[model samples]
Target: MKMKTAVLMAAVLAGGAACFAAGAAELAKVENWPRWRGPQDNGSTEAGRYPVKWSGTENVLWKAELPGKGCSTPIVWEQRIYVTAPVAGQDALLAFDWAGKALWQTTVGAEKPGKHRNGSGCNPSPTTDGVSLFATFKSGNLAAFDFTGKVLWRTNLVEKYGRDTLYWDYGISPVLTEKFVVVTMMHQGESWLAAWDKRTGALGWKVARNYKTPVENDHSYATPIVVRQAGAEVLLVWGAEHVTAHAAATGEVLWSVGDFNPGGQKNWVAVSSPVLAADVLVVPYGRGARLHGVKLGGSGDVTATHRLWKREDTGTFVPTPAAYKGKVYLVRDRGEVECLDPVSGKTEWTGQLPKSGANYYSSPAIADGKVYAAREDGVVFVARVEGKFEVLSENNMGERVIAAPVPVGNRLLLRGERTLFCIAAQ
Candidate 1:
């Protein structure tokens, strides 16, 4: 009788765990890059001694050839790496071990190829909580998988809700809290912030997040951020000419900050996501024309009260700013770099990379006092950004790269158009 019950449990675990709802015991550590924006959601990590000089062949620990091109950055936990890419003609999730060996591949739904030259069907990066992984695609496929590559649950948001009407590919990656995995949609019609059960894939709640703005300002490809305020978790979402906060559990609107476009600027769509530097949230808007700094806590409309400062002289359009050691760093779209004081929104120092005809699509990343910025044309520049800004070295990957550089535990992962290269001092 005991043996029969044990066998039944094993069979059920291999398929799905909705009834069990139990996950692995290991929690995410400081060395893990659990999500696309990195573990802290600011595109910087201090746990690794990253390489400042390396070529395609030098310091290349290992390279795993991906099945197809994906603009999403790879997330790492411990020795495992997870990435979302289209396999053959279907959207798929792939797993790889520490030694660049492919472990498994699981396909979820049909692929809807991207419209832009760098876009793809699997543009959103896969996120993990050190137990199960989650991914969303442009085709509206939302699926969860256990560590062993078993399909836990799957659904299509486009089929259930409606198709996305964004001008570019769907790029906002999913974010996770302790109890739920939340997704934000800020397109032209019926924008919302919805949460789903991390284990069962069930909808928990959805709250409307509509606002009035100029043309194309309603559409947002920026991911929502989880923050702590007054001993509770809040979601910081940016779109439609405002930055709003909502209760993570109930999806209730907490507060909002507006007046970003006083001139009613047209076609000033949001591309880069915001980053948190200590208590300040740095937002880049107006297609590289402006930057604003807002405080973290408030209720109702706090546009006038919570705003720290605003800058119109410099900002980024595609590359999100990276926060390191309480300072917000901007590797602007045209390779001009600026380090700002988050508290005052003042520029601390300024520098520039080698001027490139191609803009920067991959956001800058910092690890161990070094900065890594990649251009769309495949050249990556490393710089020392601590006291005096100094250019480190330039590396050419010889392929298009849109994914941000991920550094964790002495290894730097660069996802290019042809392969995923792991860099370390081996």
Candidate 2:
């Protein structure tokens, strides 16, 4: 059966490679963010010189009010920015131009809001390949749109597959590779990872992920990221007390590390995605600050030998850590940021956020020699990435901020509770 599955996946990948080659080529030449974690899937951008300070009315280039609430970060491609929201009982996608003017808004599906406190219908961010935009919602509706807001293809995963049994809302953004749009749905019931053809909404491959973890630990709100290992791109999926690396061309498991929940804690639900720095994959186990670094390359069950380092003091619950310049920065839930050396897992420096008692759900964005960390109370603390953790600026939006800040060109795009602000140099 395993041999048959491998042979089928290889045939599917070979058939779709030619169809998506042009789109993949266009994606490589585009400088804008095409996915959830910027160009490289690590929350870092090459565009430098963002504004050092900004507020509700100060240093703000343009501010436009969104129709409803969402936690998904805005993605930029070429001259437009795309974001998803739940507006008037419908899951909608809103587009804005580089000037901050609202261009178009298209309703994708009926809103199926989650029952959790921080849950929303439109939690997953969209992905693009310089041609069309792909978005998924908590409604299980995944759709594709052109640059002018015209719907190309649409499908509902819950209706075709099974209903998502997630505790909170579905927040995993769609991952776009060379030939496939991969989506992972892992929850209490039947969990699976599936891939679809990027142009046509046809299913390419689906694989069931079986695990023996506790019920609560069976959920994952994290997104999948691609990493290059041994001359091949591998998709990294984290959930159910394990970090598994799958072949990007096909949904075959390459390697997995299952020691993330050694104590068998049931409530250690994974919220943060794994951040890859070169060949080392950093996996963060929720609630305990338990982090493990696994060296890439190897076959199945490499947990014992490939595990390089483990640390318990630097674990984070909500926000995903950012890696830049050979250092990893972790933002704790209660407004503390710590920088760790990727090699030895040693703390370089620890700094406190501007506002105390404020929770940070947004991941940190590292670029232009600074780290931008947003607090739940709408204050974005910008600190220098160099010598002694010096705070460069603290800009408050005066509204709740849940989405991570995105840096494009020379501006910082900040999505608050009800407004999107473009901060540039005055």
**Global lDDT scores for all candidate models:** 0.82, 0.77
Candidate 1 matches the true fold with a TM-score of 0.92
Candidate 2 stretches greater than 4 Å from native: 1-30
What are the per-residue Cα lDDT tens digits for candidate 1 across 1-426?
011010000000001101111124311332788888887888898775778777756887778888887788889876788998889989999998766778899999999987767677777888998889999888989899999889999989899889887777888888988778888888888988889999999999988888887888887877878988888899999888899998888999899999999999787777788999978999998878899999988789999999999999989877888999999999977789999999999999999998866877788899889899987778889999998899989999878788888988677888886588877765
**Cα error of candidate 2 at position 301, Å:** 1.0
**lDDT, model 1, position 232:** 89
Clashes of 2: 1
Model 1 clashing residue pairs (backbone): none
lDDT of 2 by residue, 227-298 (tens): 777778788898898888899887899998887777776677778877777567777785637888878778
**Top candidate by TM-score:** 1
Candidate 1 regions exceeding 4 Å error are: 1-30
